[model samples]
Target: MAAAATSTSTTQLSAPYRRSSTLQNSNYNKNNNSNKVPSNGVNGDRQVMVSKRGCNGVDNGGGFCWKASFMYWTLEDVAHVARHHWILCLFAVGLLFFMAVEYTLRMVPASSPPFDLGFVATRCLHRLLESWPELNTLLAALNTVFVGMQTTYIVWAWLIEGRPRATISALFMFTCRGILGYSTQLPLPQGFLGSGADFPVGNVSFFLFFSGHVAGSVIASLDMRRMQRWEMAWLFDVLNVFQAIRLLGTRGHYTIDLAVGFGAGYLFDSLAGKYEESKRRTSLLLHKEASLT
Candidate 1:
């Protein structure tokens, strides 16, 4: 009975110590859990925070941190876009302004004098030419000489230099020009200065939709550039500009015609290049097949 009592007392005394240890262990586990960052919660939500030094030495979380406020994020994105595409932004503003201008623009009356900015700018020159028919003829003669030069360069590139690209481009451009020109024949402009020495001499009928003169010059200039003849190319470009101005002053071609001529020259050159490349690829394929056989 004494031993049984002693054992019972020992059990009662150890029970409080065990309970205190259990409580301490539970508190420690709770503290550890509270200190730990949650990778995932019961609802599968994950939250993370990382500190990193920013450009200004302040903690910015990280380089691509998403913890920033909405307004700040939006402003950062806007600044990034603006820095890279400022020109695009400028054009966008221009687009809006032009839209407003177009909306407010008045329609021109049919009876109103044909208003052309180029014509107005060259009014004095035009008057001088009108007064001196001989001077106009002389200018036409000089322009013809320039045309001859362009023709010589193009032909020489094909026949002498063994480069057919310019020739092919010229042929393609002229053929397309002929088709387009005949399809819609614009009436001759008023106050046109005719010259006996001009191409299609004696005021013969010609297409007015696009200027072949400008197109031909562009073709020659492009070929010169390809040949690395910088001096010749520059000369062609300057003469081409003068030719365009003279054409405009003489009422030889409309503004749209000259612009389209420039485009056509570039377009035809590209097409010709593509054609040559295709031909070369075909030849290579045929040779390879023959060798394999």
Candidate 2:
């Protein structure tokens, strides 16, 4: 009797473990099954299913299915994702664009001198506003603030929000501005006179046709808009207008320059928004399909 009771207890203990092993195998099989689909799975069914192994390996789908939360994507997550192929490509493009812009600024002179509307507008604005010393000081202060805000926003977008689009947009604007700047090679307005501090680089005798400040402002503004920060968008828009006026008032740029800058920046912003939205939608669809499967 004693031996039989002992044997029964051992079997009872082993029974639970046996059941546990079977449950684990069942789960494993289910996961494996998810990677397979019925013959009609690929047909035009209203509902679709996705498999993790199939999506990540069997197909050439990119690694963008991972869910992202704005509050959770810390700098570390950004660094991790920055190593992705697409991000790497963006970085390469941004670097090349930056170098091109810098080279253009340093080497190219305007192919033709400024004439017509740009020169006339600059001449008039300089004559009217160049004499106001206090106004110049205030404009300088505003420009400084604008630069500070733009830099901060870029850092936040790229690092905190994990947005590579911001970097690309900035590089694009710089390249466009540089190309225009070198192409126009227009001289400063005839009455262009301001505090000597305005041209710290001492090349104030010329360099016109497009305003980098206004372009930078516009890019920053549009980036803020994409982030869905209405307050920031409004603030940057107002600052951009002020920056454009400052460029004209200080004889730093012509009206045409501001207009071109605005156009180019706005165009880039639209393109970036579309690209980002498409990527987001693709990722969500894949995730949902995978979950359903």
lDDT of each: 0.78, 0.63
What is the lDDT for 287 in model 2? 100
Task: Identify the candidate with maximal TM-score.
Answer: 1
- Return the TM-score for each candidate structure: 0.70, 0.49
Over the stretch 1-293, how does candidate 2's per-residue lDDT look in tens digits? 99998656443312323334455447756765786544463431211322332221222243223222333445544554454445676988899999988878644356744444654545655555656677676667667677777877876788988886766677776776667678766666545545544533333454465666666677787777766888988988888886776676676666777787788777776666677799999999999999999
lDDT of 1 by residue, 189-220 (tens): 77788888887678788998788999999999
| Model 2: colliding residue pairs | none
- Model 2, residue 216: displacement in angstroms? 1.5
Best by lDDT: 1
Report model 1's TM-score to 2 decimal places: 0.70
Residue 113 in candidate 1, Cα distance off native in Å: 5.7
RMSD of candidates 1 onward, in order: 21.1, 22.0
Global local distance difference test of model 2? 0.63
